[model samples]
Target: MQDCRILITRPEPENTLTCERLNTHGWSAVPLPMMEIFPLKDTNKKAVIRAQIFDIDTFDYVIFVSKNAARLACDWLDECWPMLPANVHWIGIGQGTTQTLLNEGVPALSNPGHTTETLLDWLKPARMRDQKILIIRGEGGRPELGNKLEERGAKVSYLSLYERKKPQYSAQTFFMLPDINLIWITSGESLLNLSEYVSLHKPEWKVLPVLTPSIRVAQQAKKMGWINASCANGADDNSMIKATEFHIGKQND
Candidate 1:
């Protein structure tokens, strides 16, 4: 793994950190953000988001679906609330998301992938029949969380703070990709964007090793015709690094 060159496809800020982490762990990391995040700008969507923020106290729990959502939730709370509601719980599905909340001085119960099952297991003993939940996320996120909450009878609502768009990489940029040994993808959308690039250009790269943050996302990559996609235990830094190491070892073997 000493010569491992990994292609990081996460969005900015996070991708910068990921590159640093990978380098620290002895991997050569290349950052080429496949997707970019942008806040909702349509007046009608903005109004809907504002209305949700205004009614924040009404929900029993507010769950952030990503690091982007958590940060935006902080911003929205700042716009209207003098103080955070005392009774409402905050949830973030991954370590990155949870850490984002912590950075904002919000103690989230759980939402990072490794911790998500713990949150659901914790709910098993509670009465969700009458609970109210608000899931804050970017556009086109998976609906499984809300669907599961509803299955338990919790009234579920969603607030989308941003949209994830494929970045416009120049044709030259695609041609200049490193001799990457591994590709790291944390989200389905990231995988989708990368697949689009591979589909249009280096079709042979489909067989290159891919490391995904979760089994669900790995499955998605496979369904999309990725020839070799590996699953990490979770999206937390340790899990990703460990999975990357596994891919490295397996390749070297």
Candidate 2:
């Protein structure tokens, strides 16, 4: 027993899922969601719909950055182009997104690791050149992936599927201690959102040792004055659990 009770700062329902997993490991999970996600009001919804009706042969590849993006793209594609062309190359950022594509009966190649750099590294000089790639993602995501692909001479278009917003405060968050042992921040936005919340409300949960999934997010946490932050190698559930274990163990020692 590590006596490592963790607090997850992912927004809402996701915190419940993380808490459930921590419970299985006999650790307490404290939820203090840092942000909220809402659907972006697409001004070009009709255009998106119209484009979806086009032949799949028009595009060489479809890139999905997150499971949410994959699900939304798959749903939209299914509505317009009921039968997906077998020739289209589908790229998933990680196993979760890959699984989402697989469930939708789409053949997709997943990046070995769940980061923008990892995904670009996997494509490299061989696969990305001259490809017409459609990237389905959330609004305000890092443009590094698209910019890198463009640098390699690949034609890339971004399709914004959703928007992320700040979640309202819960009284539970007001009661949390300022220095929780570990703060689970799954996204850069969440880290920034938490900082914003602190700046506004001066909540009890202040600076914390953050557990993040990527180096960029860790950097963001540090920039926000979170002194201790550890980046998981990947975004998988096991990776988060193991990263948490290591940080908590280090603290105990």
The models' CA-based lDDT, in order, is 0.83, 0.76
RMSD of each: 2.1, 2.7
**Candidate 1: clashing pairs of residues:** 92-111, 93-111, 93-112, 94-111, 94-112, 95-112
Residue range 48-132, candidate 2, lDDT tens digits? 7447436445778888888777777787788777788878888898776788799998889887888889988888846667888
Residue pairs with backbone overlap in model 2: none
Off by over 4 Å in 2: 1-3, 41-50, 53-56, 170-173, 176-179, 200-207
lDDT of 1 by residue, 30-92 (tens): 999988999999999989988989999999989887888898889989898878888998878
Model 2 has an lDDT value of 0.76
